[model samples]
Target: MLAATKRVAFGAAVMALAVGLAGCSGSGGSEADEGGTKGAPGAKKAPGPENAVRLIGDGSTAFTGAQPNITPPQRLKPGEKPPQFVVFSWDGAGEDSQKLFSHFRQVAKKYDAKMTYFLSAVYLLPEEKARLYDPPKHDIGTSDIGFGDTQGIKDTLRELRAAWHEGSEIGTHFNGHFCGKEGGVGTWSVEEWKSEINQAKSFVENWKTNADLPDEAPLPFDYAKEVVGGRTPCLEGQKNMMAAARTMGFRYDSSGIGNQIWPKKTDGLWDLPLQLVPVPGREFETLSMDYNFMYNQSGTTSGDPDEHEYWGNQMRDGLLQAFDRAYEGNRAPLIIGNHFESWNGGTYMRAVEDTIKTVCVQRDVQCVTFRQLADWLDAQDPATLEKLRGLKVGEAPRAGWPAFTATDTAPADRTEKH
Candidate 1:
């Protein structure tokens, strides 16, 4: 039954087309980072420090008490079937004219979901400060995705502040959105990747100094400690990127490809890659992302207006089918990726919003961020995770869960100190 669904979800032709499109461009970040910064500049003072806030780095970010709206993971009881975990993560997150970042924040709140937002550092760095960003293998101030205007930066800051306070995780999508053979991230050396990562962090840590937005409230969490993982632009450079991430104390990487099954560690970090999910009315799987569906369906970002509704339904149904397979069969965590763009006449955005509303409220469903997922994965017994890893895609244990985990017992919760 699961195999049949998989076949119907993705067609061979569709998969081939998506693969080709992926190589050409990706949905995470735009391919236009090659322009100078152009915007008026004036820094606003960061919000006055409160009792809970400890100002850090030119008052751009602060260390507050434990993040609100976050709960420690509880170990699974013996012989218990795992609850379905669904992670809705966005790459290159920023609030632009479309206001998708803020829009989704409200949507997540309505659905009782917590998400990960992979913030591109360039979004916070104003256009005037573009030269401050030294992207590896790219000219200074040269960004394939361009720099943010002052108003855009301010809007992004507001959302980032609110989102973190509301329990969302803020991860980095690195600096530039460079792809392809000519100075693409894939060609960057380990040292170059490290430089990019540092610059990304530096921009977040010193936004006040660079943007001169002193009056705005400092970002609520210590970005240095709060950021635990991120997805790479275009999902490239995982090999060296993972090496850099581990050394830099990152806990996970969500930039690879995988089937709808249990995740495991790679290069000392949780390898929570984007999954292959069903695409309704198709016979081959595509990555669980809005852009992949858009590419496969329209063959362009903006296709025929009349087909938008059908395309949206196809994506929604595909994700739902993928969720059911895990919920009923293997119970692997579902990781879905999206961007802030409104591709295919905003149909993909609508599809994603619909998917979140439908799945997040289901019984035994926990909508969490990658950081939360990693913490939960870490808290589990290694033996139990190993057993879970043994289950193939959509393959449940021959014995029922109770018998399958008969010897297992819930371990004491190991809560981390804030």
Candidate 2:
């Protein structure tokens, strides 16, 4: 999926119209407050000052209270079975005529799931303000995907505000959708990538100033703090991009390919690569992304309408098979990537929606954003994680978790025995 030639093209008019628009702490409690049904002894009260909202930079973003609907991550107890994690993420997420972004938000809510929307910065910059973006290696104001119009920006903002309030994460897909060798992201240097990252941040932080929509309510969360990770454009330039991301305090990078195994750190950051999954009715597997599936199934974004339903079922079944492999075996996190476009008569959308409804409601299954997944990973004990990493793709611990982790208590003895 990281191949430069895998880039998808969008209509210029569609691109021009989509410019888009578009934390907490605790403290000690008093004795009376403790007994007054407020909270347990020494437990922090809910809805306290930690939820207070503080406006930031041109009022484009704010430090709203703790994100709603996100459960705090707890360290996994020794020998405990891990939850089956499934992450459904979208690239270049925005609102347009198709309404795919908003539709997916509703789908997530219905299934008790949260998603990561990797927004393209240009979607917020109105077509009139195109010159504000100086894309790396591209001509001034030149974006392969054009800027959004006023109405498009307004709709995107509405959806973004609502999505965050519902506990969904907002990430970046960088600026331009540049891929391949000619000035594409694959050829970018660390410095060029840094410039692009900064520009992406700047566009989000100054949307109000640049677009002149002063009266609009500020975004609910601070972009700088909210955006801790992102998938690079077309999944290219990942090596240099990771270098830039580490310097920018990013916690994870999801722009590579890997098998269904536990994630590990790269350059001190989580390398949460997309995994290969079964392709229904086929002997081979493919990247767990809608685009990859579409490419393999139809060889183009828009395929035969007569086979749309079949394609949808194929994707849905493939993802489920992949989910079960990890769920019943190694228990590795399943990462699924998608886009907002209605490829193959919107069959992929339907497939994803059905997948969410089916998988998220199952026992011990958590459909979460990359941010939440990263938090859970960070909260676990290193030894347990190391044990998890030892499991090969789809390979469960034959001795079960109890015996598998029993060596933690006698590391030195285990070493000597080995």
Give one digit per residue, the lDDT tens place, for model 2 in 1-418: 0101123633111112111000000000011111222567897656555646688989888887677778999888876889999999998777777778878888888899999988888888877788988888898887766677667677778778888877789998888777656897879999999999899988888888888999887777888878889887667789999999899978999988788989999998899988888887886787788877776777667789999999999999999999988887778999998888778898988899989999999999999999999999999989888878877777767656566666454332111110
lDDT of each: 0.79, 0.78
List ranges where model 1 is wrong by over 4 Å.
Answer: 1-51, 408-418
Task: Give the range of the ten consecutive residues with the poorest summed lDDT in model 1.
Answer: 1-10
Report the lDDT of model 2 for residue 362. Answer: 98
Candidate 1 accuracy as TM-score: 0.87
Per-residue lDDT tens digits of candidate 1, residues 113-198? 99999998877777788899888887898877777766777788888888887888999888778876678888999999899998
What is candidate 2's local distance difference test score? 0.78
